[model samples]
Each structure stands twice: as structure tokens, then as C-alpha cells.
Target: MSVMLLIEQVLNGLQYGVMLFLMAAGLTLVFGVMGLINLAHGSLYMVGAFACAGVAAATGSFWLGLAASLAAAAAAGALVEVAVIRRLYDRDHLDQVLATFALILVFSEGTRWLFGSFPLYLSVPEVLSGAVTLPGGIEYSLYRLAIIVAGFAVAAGLFWLIGRTRLGVRIRAGESDREMIAALGVDIRKLYTVVFALGAALAGLAGALVGTIQSVQVGMGEPVLILAFVVIVIGGIGSIKGALVGALLVGMTDTLGKVLLPVAFGTVMDASDATAIGSALASMLIYILMAGVLIYRPQGLFGEAH
Candidate 1:
């Protein structure tokens, strides 16, 4: 590959990484603070994409659709937490998993009922539709670059929220000891709801942003959900910093592996065989990276050893 091509692939990796960060960050927060294993989190992601697509289609404003996505996802998240998740806090992981898995079905069916089964397309906003030239004269998608910037911005905001704000203090405390925080007159239940909603909104934002590049449709979040889980595992559960780092690592490994591995194999083997082998290995790269991380640090990169 030429230098420019390599540079572009790196940028693509970064963009993909940030998107995973968006999903993983929220997931870690919910697990970290609430001790609840929510398998249905991806449903909120779907909610956001559908909301953005439906609203933007009706109003012809991508911005409005984006806002709606946040609002709708957050609302749906809060509702789910109040109606179902709160009950799962004291239950075992198996119970939480079962309940949330049921929620996945509910969300999938509800969304299908409302929107039908057709895939919806979200157009790139006019201002973000074209390619932009980088300093090295590399052309890249402006919207994807925007997604990277937005993801980093959200990461910074989350850091601030968890480290600097009063709510942050409570979240940290809750993570360490929920019973103590509740004894200290903190309404742990309310905090859990807020955290859940925040996580949902982040997932929704990710779905909406990614929807423009891919088709917005039912069951889309399930595949991404699996990757998000891998990200959190590699980063160390409950660590935002870990999530971002892990996301970038996985993204780079997956993207570059796909691009570079075939070339490396091509030098030694027939082109067709190299392509097939490279593609197969590339698909396994992220999971391999996760397993490596676990071997090095079973608790995850940033997860505290208990």
C-alpha cells in the first residue's frame, strides 16, 4: 500500500475505534456503578437509530434527528431501568442476564411493530457529506472524522463527569460500596437510573452516527454489542480510560490486520489462498487481542483486582 493508503486505513481504524468507545463507555459505566449485567443495552442503541431516522425523515433535519435520538434513548433507558433493571440489582447475574435478554426481545418486537422490517437510510448531513484534505494531502470522509472528534469529546466529558463532578464522586463511591452510599443518604436508586440513562444515550448516539455510514435497521446493534463487550473486557470493566484504549487497540488491530495480513501472506502463498486465510485471521484478531489481554491481566487492563 502507498503511504496515503496506509494513512487512510489508520484513520479508518481510529474512526471505528471511537465508535466502539461510544458503546463501551456507557456499558462500563452501567456495569461499574449498578453491578447489573444488562444484555439489552444494545436495544437502546437501536432505539436511537430508529428515532433519528424517523424524525430526520419527517423533518428533513439531521440535527433534529440527532437530538431526538439522545432524548428518545435516554427516556427509553430510564424507563427500562425504573420498570425492570432496578429489580435486578440484588439478583444474581443469571437473573439479570435472563431479564435483560427478555428485554432484547421486547425491544426488537416493539421496534418492528412501529417501523416495520425495512431498513432506513440516514443521509450524511450537507455540511459533513464530503471529503476533507488532511495536512499530508490525504483525503478522508469529513463525517467519519467528525465522529472521531465527537467520540473523543464525549470521552473527555465522561472523564470530567466521573472525576470532577459531585455526581462523579457518588458514582465512584457507589462502585466501591453501594450499601455505604445508600446509608450516607445518597439515593442510590436514582443514581442508578441516571447512569443507565446516560449509558443509553451514549449508545444511541453511537447508533445514530454509525447509521449514516451503514443502514439503520432492526437487529443491527447485536453485532456491535458483541464488540462493545469485547472492548470493555479488554479495557477492564468499569474503566472509561480502559474502554477508549481498548477500543483504539481493537480497531487498529482489526483494520490493519485485514489490510496488512493479506499482503504479508501474498508474499509467501498464492494470492487467492492468502486472501481467504488473511480474511479469516482478520476476523479473529480482536478476539485474539482480548484473550491476550486477559492472560496478561485477568481483571482487565484497568479493572481493579478483587
Candidate 2:
């Protein structure tokens, strides 16, 4: 491939990685802190997309839609945690999974009932709708680049929140010993709700950001959720740093594989066959990478060994 094309693909990979990080970050946090298997987390993502689309359509402003997404998703997460998740904390993973899976159905049908079976469209804000030139005369989508920047900014903000804030201290404490923190006067229940809401807001922001590029529809979050789970598994269950690293690796592997694999195969095979075979292998690259990582570091790159 040409140098310019390669650079563009790399950038695309970064954008996709950022999206995955947003989804995975929340998922890891919830799993790590609450020890809850939340199949319904994806539902919060769908909620954000729908909320963003609906509000933006009503208000004629994407900004309002974005805000609505964060609010709606956070609210939904908090409500879910209070009404359902708290009960599951004392239950086994099987119960958590089954209950949350039921939640997926509740959310899907509820959304379909409200929005109909048709997909909703979200337009990129006017200011972010174009392309920009890079140093080597490479042109890239301004919106995608913005997403990469925003994702990193969110990462930095999360680091600051976790490392510098009191709530961060509480979160860390809760992860280590929820009972001790509760004994020390921390409202463990409140902390769980807040953390869950924060995670939900992140997922919502991801959904809203991506909705502009894709259709905002029911069940949209499920596929992304699967990838997010893979990301957390590869990165280590609860490590944000691991999530970011794992997401970038996955994004690069998946994106570059699709581009490069076909060309590699074309060298020795018929063009049509090469494309077909290459695409199939490209689909397997991330899983292969995950398995390799497991072989080398069973706890993941950043996960603490048990």
C-alpha cells in the first residue's frame, strides 16, 4: 500500500480504538468494582444513542443531543443499579448474567416500542463535518481526529479523577476492600451507584459520538459490547491503562489486517480468492492476538497476577 493510504488507515485505527476504549473503560470499571456481569451495559449505550438522536432532532442541535445522551445514560444506569444491580452484588455471576440478559430484552423492546423499528440518524455538527490536512499533505476526517483527541482527553481526565480526587481514593479503596471502606464511613452503596453512573456516561458518550457515523438503532450496542468485553479481557479485567493499550492494539490489528492482508494474499493467489481469504483471516487476527497474550500473560499485560 502507498504511504498515504497506510497513514490514513492508521488514523482510522486510532479512531476506532478510541471508540472501543470508551466502551471498554466503563465495562472494566463496573466489572472490577462491582464484580457484576452486566450484559445490560450495552443497553445503556443504546439509551445514549437514542436519547442523543431524539433530543438533537427535537432541538435542532447536536450539542444538546450529546448532553442528553450523557444524562439519560447516567440516569438509566443509576436506576438500574439501585433497582436491580445492588441485589445481584450478593448473588453469583450466573444470576447477574441472567438478570442483566433479561434487562437486554427489556431495554430492546422498550426502545423499539418508543422509537419504532426504523433507525434514527444523527448528523455531525457543522463545525466538525469536514476534512483537515496533515503534515505530509494527508487529508483526514476532522471528526474522527476529534474523537481520538477527545478519547485521550477523557483518559487523562479519568486518570486525574482516579489518582487525585477523593472519590478516586474511595473507588480504589472499594476495589480493594468494600467492607473496610464501609467501616470507615464510606457509603459503599452510593459509591457503587456513582461509579456505575460514571461508566454509563462514558458508554453513552461513546454511543453519541459514534452515532453520527453510524445509524442510531436498537441493538446497536451489542456488537460493540462484545468487542468491549474482548478488550477488557485482553487488557486485564480492571485496568484502565490496560484497556487503552489493548484497545489500540486491537484497533491497529483489526484495521491494518483488513487493509494489508488482502494485498499479502494477492501476491500468490487470484484476486477474488485473496480478498475472501484475507478478509476471513483479518477477522480472526484480534482473537489470535488475544490468545497469544493469554499464553504470555495470563493476567493480561497490566493485570495483577492472582
Candidate 3:
């Protein structure tokens, strides 16, 4: 492999992994703190994208659109938790699954009704619209570089929130002993709502950022949602650290596989056939990683779930 090409691909993988970490971190938080199986998490992500797109289109300000995404997603999440989600807290996993799955249909149809079936476009800000050369003589999109920086900043903030703050203490206490925390004058219901909303906001931010790179359309969240689940599973569910590590691993594996698999196959077979086969196999690399993880530690790398 050419060294420059390898470097570029590694950077691509890093960017992809950071995006996945955003989605997975939120998901893991909800699972860790609330014990809720929310299949509609993807719906919140789609909500963020639509909110950003609509607001940006109206005001022609990317920053305003970003703010709107966070607000809209947090509001939607809180409302849902207060309504449908509250009822399902005491229900079995199957019932929760059935209810959340229904929500996915509701969100998709509602979004289509409001925004139309066509995809909406979100342009990157002029300040971040161009490419910047790195110290290694590599040029990368400024927006993408911003995303990486933002992801790391969020990760650091999340770590501090979970490990240092009073709210973090309460969250950990709730996760470990919900009943005990409630008995000690803590409002468990309110805490759950806050945690859920926080997670929703993170997912929303991810959607808003990704919208600049891809179409902001209905059902867009579903694919990324699936990958996020895979990330948490391999890294260990309910663990933010696990989510970050798992995301990077999945990102690297998938990225490198797509590039290397075809080349290796081409050494032995026709180039076109090699490319097609390699592409197909590369798509499954993350799942293969998941399978490998599950075989050895079903609870996940950082997961306490048994």
C-alpha cells in the first residue's frame, strides 16, 4: 500500500469512528443508566437532522440550525419519555421492544409528512467549507476536522460529567441501585427523563453534523443506528469507554478492509471480481468483529450486563 494512501485512509477511519462514538455514547448512556431498550433512538437522530435542515434552510445559518437540532431533539426526547416511555419502564423487554419499534414507524411517517419524501440539503459553513493541509502534507476537509475535534471535546466533557459532577454521582448511583437512590430523596423519574434527554441530544448533534456530509432524509438514522448498536455490543454495552474504543476499532477494521481486501484478492483473481467481492465482505467486517467479541466475552469489553 502507498504510504500516503494509507495515511489518508487512516484519517478517514478516525473520522468515521468519531461519528460512531457520538451515536454509541448516547445509546450506551441510556442503556447504562435507564435500562431501557429504545429502538426509537434512531427516530430522535432523524429528528435532529430534520430540525437542523429546516432551521438552516429558513435562516441560512448553520449555527442556528445546530442550536435548533439540540433543542428540538432534547424537547422531543423529554416529551416521549414523559408520555410513552414512562409507561414502559416497568414492562418486559419484549413489550418495550414492541412499543419502541412502533415509534420508529410513527417518526418516519411523521417526518415524511412534514418534510416531504425528498432529502433536504445542508451546506457546510463557509469557514469550514474548504480543505486545510495537515503537517504531514495531507489536505483534509475543514468541516470533517472540526467534527473530529468536536467529538474529542464531547468525549472529554462526558467523562467529566460522568466521573466528577454531582449529577454524575447521582447517575451512577441510579444505575447501580435505582431503588436505593429513589429511597434517598432522589427523584428517579426526573433523573431518567434527564438522562434520556441528554442521550437524545447527543444523537441529534451527531445527525446534525452528519447532515452536512450526507442527505438529511427520512430513515437515514436507521443504518447509523444499527452500526451504533454494533459498536456498543463489541465494546461492551453501557460503557462510554467501551463505545469509544469499539467505535475506533470498528472504524479501522471496516475502512482498512475495504481498501486492503480488494488489493489482496486482485493479486489472485480478476480485478473487477475482486473489487465486488471485497466490497461485500468489507460491509460485514464490523459484524464479524462483533461475533468475535461475543464469542469470548458476551458481556462486552466494558459492559457489566450479564
Candidate 4:
């Protein structure tokens, strides 16, 4: 109810939104460029978290762990692309989904076997572990604010990479017409592998970043993966800008709804009932938002009209 609480919630929403953006960006890119439905993408997220936890524990350096997350995820993605996903490109979405679902099982079980069922924790570095005062005299966690900054930095860098680089041009060309791009002397297969690896790295970065705040455990990526799907669908499947916008929208709506709805309902209902109903609605808000977007703009907010 207080102004400080409101500010803190908004900041929380922004941090969450940015993390979702990181995850959704990769999903959108992979879908746009490769046309593959990878159910195992979330498994890559778990992989990143595990790698970060393991490496950080061994080396006592969060930075090294972060680097390991990126490298391990990228390598895993490339290997998957070459060994399994490449074969699924020409197949139907159903087949792609099934194969990737199998991958999820393999990844989850494999990680459990390697790491055991116990959850791992990643500690925020000492420098980032404290709070900073905001302009309104509100103290906020520095680590969370750092996440927001890092997320935005990555988003901007990704936009530049996709919009200004030669690789971006090739990616666009591949997205538009894979066969034509191949005819034009591009190694389409290699390009797809690179894109998948890049996407996987982004997901890994998100996982590593979040692991500091939450426990790293098996199947940790599934819920976030579903949310990322909602983000891509609401934003438009292949549009990065849409993914960004949709992620922020979903994040704010979900966060604000949870915080504000109960108060609004308390006026009309008992506190307990209001809390229950508000929580339920908050969980459904993003999906409802996605449905509304689909009804109005089938292609998505930033998607090209088809």
C-alpha cells in the first residue's frame, strides 16, 4: 500500500520482465530462423543453471560460472542441432515437438543423475549483494537492479547484432527463404547451428542470472519456458521487438495484478477469499492477455501481417 512498496514491486516487475525477455528472445529467434519447435529449450536453461552452480562451487567465482553457463549451453545446443534437431528441420512440427519432448526427459533425468535431486544455490557476488537507495528514498536490491541493467544491455546488443551485422542479414535471408539463401552460397546448416547456439547461450545467461536469486534445480526451466511461450505467442512468434514488448507487458501485468488485485477484491470480499481469487486470476492474466492479442492481431503486435 505504501509508495515504497509500489516502487519495489514495479522494480521487481521490470527485473522479471527483462529476464523473460532474455528467454523469449532466444525462443523467438530460434523459431523465426529455424522453424523448429524445440520443447527442450527449457532443458538448456536447466543445463545453464547446473553448469553455473557446479563451476561456481569448484572455482569460487561467480564470473567463471557465468562464462561456463554460456559456453556449456552453446556447446550443448550446437551438439543437439547437429545430432538431432538438424534431422527434424524438414519434418513436421508434431515430430519436432515429440523429439524435443524426448530430449526434455533425457536432459532432466541426466541432470538428476549427475547432480542428484538436491537443489544448488548460486550466491550473489559481495559487491552486488547490498541495497541502493533510489531517487524516492526507496532502498532496492542492487543485484536485482543489476539484472535489469544486464538484461537491457543484452537486449540492445541483440538488436544491434540482428539489425546491423552481416550475420543479421544472413539470418534475415534465411528466415525469409532458406532454400534461396542456400542457393546463394550460404552454408544454411551451419547458420542454423550458430543461431541455435546463440539462442541457447542467451537462455543460459538468463538461467545463470536467475540462479543467484533462486535455487538451481532439475526442471527449473519448465515454468519459465511456458511463460516464454506465452511471451512469443503474444508478441508474435518470430518478432524480437514483439517478444520484448510482450515480455514486459506480461511481467508488469502479472506482477501488478498479484499485488493490486487482492486489495481491490478485499473491498468486496473477505480477505482470505480475495487473496485466493486474486492469486488465481494473476496466474491466468498472461494467458488471457495472450488470447486477447490473438483475437485482435493474429500475427502478434510486432509481427508482419500475413
lDDT of 1: 0.94
Ranking of all candidate structures by their TM-score, best first:
1, 2, 4, 3
lDDT of 2 by residue, 19-76 (tens): 9999998999999888887899899999999999999999999999999999999999
> Least accurate stretch of 10 residues (summed lDDT) in model 1?
32-41
Mark the regions of model 2 whose C-alpha exceeds 4 Å error after superposition: none
Candidates 1 and 3, the one with greater lDDT: 1
Order of candidate numbers by lDDT, starting with the best: 1, 2, 4, 3
Model 2 pairs whose backbones collide: none
Which model is ahead, 1 or 4, in terms of lDDT? 1
Give each model a TM-score: 0.99, 0.99, 0.98, 0.98
Distance from true position, residue 140, model 4, in Å? 0.7
Query: lDDT for every model?
Result: 0.94, 0.94, 0.91, 0.93
RMSD to truth, every model: 0.7, 0.7, 1.0, 0.8
Error of 4 at 169 (Å): 0.6
Tell me which of candidates 2 and 3 scores higher on lDDT: 2
How does model 2 fare in lDDT? 0.94
- Residue 272's lDDT in candidate 3: 100
